[model samples]
Target: MLTSGRKGLEASARGTTVLLAALVLASCASGEPEAKIEHLCNVADASEEEALLRGILRADDYTTDINNRTSRVVEGLERNLRDIGPAKETLSTSMCAYKPTPRAGSDRARFEFGWVPRTSKDAEPLLSGGGRFDANGAFGESNYFQTRLFVRCDMPGDLAEPSKAAWLYARASYSFNIGRTDIDQAAKDRQTALAYLMARRVTDALGCENKPLEKPPVVKPAPTP
Candidate 1:
């Protein structure tokens, strides 16, 4: 005859295995699937910093210069939108296309671009969210900062029209107090980022990359982002 102890041990082992199997199945059902990750910009290269400083600046002269360019791009973009109204055959555009001016001996943000009609490139975006203030300065007992920014993006051209592109853009002015030396160059950078964010939101809305980005994605400043 089989011993009672042996039978008891066998029964416990069976119970444990059943419980483990149930737990595993439950976990699989409840777990979320892994998400695909995309790296936007690499922060290590200092060359990009120089490029940004050269191409992007917040001085009044640069602001005016950028705004002027923006106007031309916007005109083109608005026209494309109008033409594409209810046209089901046209494929959407997602990014801007313009021939950048050659970099010369350090010029003020006063640069010119040859706008290209209806183009799409998955260029890395520097702007895509609301303005975030980060620079801090000193004012005797208080700290403050003055910032100005202008940003613009040319929307991808209509797939139907190879000669057209759209535009989305933003501008920012900020003077604030943090009263801390801890404030850094990021303050200015955030303002710049705000402009790009506006443009990105607009491009995303064109339903080119995927479905259009959600409405009112960013207007005012959000967190450090």
Candidate 2:
């Protein structure tokens, strides 16, 4: 009787061990997909940054010595936006032609950044009415294979009054050529990164109370042409 009772207890212990192992396996299986999704959405690396800068500089076929100037112009715009007060009215700057030379084609890259007071009756209505912004508070549009990204973040503070609210906005676009019906995923990713970079700078500078923008997803490489 004693040996039989001992055997029964041993069997029960084995069953409990097996049950615990199964539960652990189930937990891991459920968590695997989320881990993979996070890995896939990793932030842009050095290569993507380099690609965007080079692409912007060589956006058009007409070659000129405006590469340095283009870089400086972009940097200056960011600085100006960051140095200004959060409640300031709309302050915007754009770079249309990097060089003085006339271009044979309309293909070009443009970078724009600005901020608008949410109190403005005219601008507030247009921005608030648009339901197109995504979870990251950004919207993108593509035309003629050109990718454009717009990002906005409303300032957070005691300014509950509509008259006191303000928002920061950034836009970036690059057009390779005209008449293409399909958009390039890689280009879109780069522009999205650029826009987020600008938005982050301004938000940090102004000390906005909003959360950081979500990282752009990694896009598969476009097929070779």
Candidate 3:
């Protein structure tokens, strides 16, 4: 009887352990999944990654770099449109002009990623909302590594309004995480990643689909002696 009681106790403990393990796993599964991101790349001759990232840094004059890039696109468009002869009047409003709309959720205090632009740069918030990244040895903080962006283009003669304006009107918001780090080399790696992303966004906003940004001029490493 004593032996039987001991065996029963052991079995019950094992069962409890399994149940607890399952619950923990289920809890994790219920939470949002983290995304995997690629590591940054650098060529032997390319500027160090930190420099690359800095290239994309928010202009000191403005807090949001993406917004500034977006504004540049808008400026170029408006400049061209102003000279487009008689088609200017048909366009209703500057598509580059955008107003901020609030996010519909209760987590406003912890996170403020949404943008209601007071100016062109304010229209879109860069890199909001946390995301998971798996970049080899790189660790990412949600606050630094996640980004969201949306650009709207109304080309005058769509189905909804078919008057006659045949120009592109666009608005865009972009966000991304630069990760958390202090090392200069590491910072460069992250910056390269951001520069690649930012360049793509700017090129797209500029309608450079067919003609992408010019490729970096290749430098043949000096002939090995």
Ranking by lDDT: 2, 1, 3
Span of 10 residues, lowest total lDDT, candidate 1: 134-143
Better of 2 and 3 by lDDT: 2
Highest-scoring model, TM-score: 2
Backbone clashes per model, in order? 13, 0, 14
- lDDT per residue for candidate 3 within 126-156, as digits (tens), equals 3343332322211222234332222222322
Tens-place lDDT digits, model 1, residues 1-225: 111122333556677677777777776798944332122111122343234432343321111122323334444445555564322222222222111233223322221112222232211123323233311110001012332222223235454233234222222223222233544445445434433333343344433343232232222433442
Candidate 2 clashing pairs?
none
Off by over 4 Å in 3: 1-72, 77-182, 209-225
lDDT per residue (tens digit) for residues 123-179 in model 2? 322321112223254544433333333445434443323313444455544444445
TM-score of candidate 3 against the unseen true structure: 0.22
- Cα displacement (angstroms), candidate 3, residue 1, comes to 76
The prediction achieving the highest lDDT against the true structure is: 2
Model-by-model lDDT, in order? Answer: 0.32, 0.42, 0.30
Of 1 and 3, which scores higher on lDDT?
Answer: 1
- Worst window of 10 by summed lDDT in candidate 3: 107-116
